[model samples]
Target: MTSSAANRRTSLSAFLLGALLLLLLGGAAAVWALNRFPQVAQLAGLQPPADALVPATQPRAVATVPIGPQPLTNAVPVDALPATEARVATLEARLARVENATSRAESSAGRADALLVAFAARRAIDRGVALGYLEPLLTERFGPTHPQAVATIVTSSRRPVRLDQLAADFAVLAPTLKAAPESDSLWQTMRRQMGDLVTIRRADQPSQRPIATYDRAVARLNSGQVDQALAEAMRLPGITAAPAWVGNARRYIAAHRALDQIESAALLAR
Candidate 1:
């Protein structure tokens, strides 16, 4: 067959088949719609047989109960539960506050302990010095025998505060209190003189200036005049700039040592 004639024959067959399928589908759709709508089914020539119209008849009644009160549960009381819960909550809150307070108290106590230990160490060093125990000051002076010095002067003596802490306090008080260099320096110089005076009691020759100051102090003290000794001490150079407490401690410790030295000397002389 020719190509154009074959194509025309195929198209005619497809068109006739499509029209037959459409007609069948339309008829099926109308029958489905009539069944779904009973009213329309009667108009579409559908009807029930005459014997199907009658219906069975009957009646029934439902029984009802009279009204009554009812209990919710046999569970524990609301008042009891709330009271217990409230007690627990209060106790927990109080515990939290106590824990916080305990932590603060622990911190404060730790600081206080450290300060006290440092002060004790300072006092120990001062006492050692007065008694001529060089071991405390010079234990680590020679070389690095250990990671930490066995006897650091600052830590060697236990006192009210560490040496560094004292230095810090001094730094603050000096500037804020308008403390004069002369005022503190005077005390410092007097303190050194006091040390020198103690050394004199030990028969150690210091500088000529210190020697002269010591001579005057000794003479005044020997004359049974406290004011005179102080007057002489104040006149010494560089004594005006020293802190009062440090100066006082220096003299006090030295004087105590001097008494010890004097007794030793007297015993030896005898």
Candidate 2:
């Protein structure tokens, strides 16, 4: 054999030996890495060694406690709930009553204030102040054409009639006639006595005098003779002396005097 051919054969044999040794060392490292970290070996496309691979284990049975019937929770007594509800209802009713009473009191106070204001305005009208000053107030309280307003005007404009004297006369006459017994004759006698007393009282009564005087005064007032009207109003006897009628008579006289004063002032100014 030639020397060159002998050298080539020696090189080929050394390469084969080196490759075999490298393959053995790589296989050992792969097995070791799979044992330490199997996920890394899997990512690298390496299979686990038979000793490193383990079969899956069955799940262990869990120890369980027996579930007996649960204990009942304590509940509120049914009777106690109704009592609490009733107490709440009673408090609500009491609050409603208090609110109603407060409303009534407020309404009464408002009416009293209105009455006082109306009385003051009436006084001013009688004290020589113009009726225009009081008209608005009266209209607000009672409408312009209301019966109450008309009555107030009429009562304030005229002297009061003394009818109380007639009541006294009737009282005196009443005792003169007795209660009749249950007999036709007694009843007739009692009727006769009553009739006689009534006739006498009627004859003595001066009832028409006040009426006549009031009519005269009203006529004078209509005729624009306020002075004459006041004179006629003053002639109403016993009206100013009677406590029941005096207040109204005074109011009427004051109104007349106010008109007279205004007229006198106007004439003087002219």
Each model's C-alpha lDDT?
A: 0.50, 0.54
**Residue 5 CA displacement from its true place in model 1, Å:** 99
TM-score (C-alpha, index-matched) for candidate 2:
0.33
Error of 2 at 53 (Å): 16
Tens digit of lDDT per residue, candidate 2, span 1-270? 699999999999999999999999998987888779977877776766555567768799999977997766786677899999999999999999999999888777756655654555445544434445455555454443243543454444343222233234323322221232334486676675565454433755533344455666556655545456556655554334333333434455454454344333323321
- Model 1 vs. true fold: TM: 0.24
How large an RMSD does model 1 have? 20.4
Candidate 2 at 160: error in angstroms? Answer: 18
Model 1 scores a C-alpha lDDT of 0.50
Give candidate 1's error at residue 242 in angstroms.
15
* Model 1 alpha-carbon drift over 4 Å, by segment: 1-81, 128-270
- Candidate 1 per-residue lDDT, tens place, 1-270, comes to 699999999999999999999999999998888878776866656766434656555566768775796666886787799899999999999999999999888776755543443344335543544213533323322223321333333332333222333334334443322222454577775676576565434357433354465456556555544345545555445445545634543443443343333223323321
